[model samples]
Target: MMRGGSNVSDAQLQQILSDVPRIINDPKTADVLVKRAEELGQKLVTERLRMAQARDIFDELRQIESIWLREPERALRRLHLLRPKLAYRRARVRELGPLAEVLERAVAEVVSAGDAAQRHDRFRRLMEFMEAIVAYHKFYGGGD
Candidate 1:
């Protein structure tokens, strides 16, 4: 049975149980920024899917690169905080784990690899992962 006060009505509260680190590390104020982050994350996901369907690797990479490069630390920080939380839920962890790895790899490759095409491919894949991460943040209303 659900207990009063112990129950959080928002679906995001369920996500918060896992995303403790994200809650701790979020720069956005708990009141104002978290909701905004969540919305932004959710919105980017549809954009990513549309780009993927169109086979628009260049466009996807361009968008992701802008976000990642402009805020590498923030991206990294978000991932760092999210990975462990997601890992706790085996099924969801399985679904999202590879994406996390892909994003991490893409960041590394983009930062280190000199080959233009390879970097572009990595960045494109990274977009998929970023979208998912953003979706997660969206689900949480930012930090949860």
Candidate 2:
């Protein structure tokens, strides 16, 4: 009494239906499902770790913005605009070698500046370098 377009035989379908409960109760199946669940849980943990690292980077960027920009609203706005790119950068930091070098140089320049004008200029360059890092991260995947 199988319907048209059905590939399964009636006896096969009946056997499968009859085996369903036994399959569900099988210890081997339960072990496989538990292993899969553990794998998924590990993936979730790894993802959370990446997100946390990204958040920490964003926090550092916010601090830099506040120190250099001085305007709360403007700093907040800029951080909001750059948040996604920053997240991407944090996740792929290892891949962004040149960008990381640029950032380090810019930070060094900012730290070494002796006067207000020089500090401001260096900070501006640092911000630009950071933006470049995010851009690079967006286009390229992380390193090994």
Candidate 3:
């Protein structure tokens, strides 16, 4: 389970558990991100993803990037903070469903990467994933 993400109900937990194997070996992380990022962006469009929510998460990502440049270890801690927020926001704003799902996956990727070097690589993937999602979201006329 992700740190501070204990709020997942039994149903959601079951769904995620079932997704684990597919998520684990469906291709390398970078390749999967490349293939699915656009689809996720489009999914957000279908979900009517809110601009304010996207902006807030994006801004937090930027902050995490800056912290990463300065303190690599601390950056990981900061990244972990997103788990709880994703859970909370997903509950409060239904439109955040797709966005929260993708973000949660990214965080899980980073958390399970196993070591500092691996985590760094996963973090880069996470960043790239979000950038692609946001770009495609805007391209798809996703608006507030």
CA-lDDT, candidates in order: 0.39, 0.40, 0.69
lDDT for each residue of candidate 3 in 1-144, tens digit (9 for 90 to 100): 121112334354345434433343343645555445556565566677866678889888888988886798888888898899989999999978767876777688777776887777667666777787787677666788
- Measured with C-alpha atoms, the lDDT of residue 76 in candidate 1 is 45
Candidate 2, residue 112: Cα displacement in angstroms equals 1.0
The lDDT, on a scale of 0 to 1, for candidate 2 is 0.40
Residue 138, candidate 3: alpha-carbon lDDT: 71
The lowest-lDDT stretch of 10 consecutive residues in candidate 1 is 1-10
Candidate 3 global CA lDDT score = 0.69
Per-model TM against the reference: 0.28, 0.37, 0.76
**Superposition error at 13 for model 1 (Å):** 20
**Tens-place lDDT digits, model 1, residues 1-144:** 111112232344334333322322333324322443343344333223232322232244444467665675554454344434434432443433333332333345444435545444444444543454454433433331
Best by lDDT: 3
Off-target runs (Cα >4 Å) in candidate 3 are 1-31
TM-score for candidate 2, please give it: 0.37
TM-score-best of 1 and 2: 2
Candidate 1 ranges with C-alpha deviation above 4 Å:
1-106
Error of 3 at 91 (Å): 0.7
The count of backbone overlaps in candidate 2 is: 0
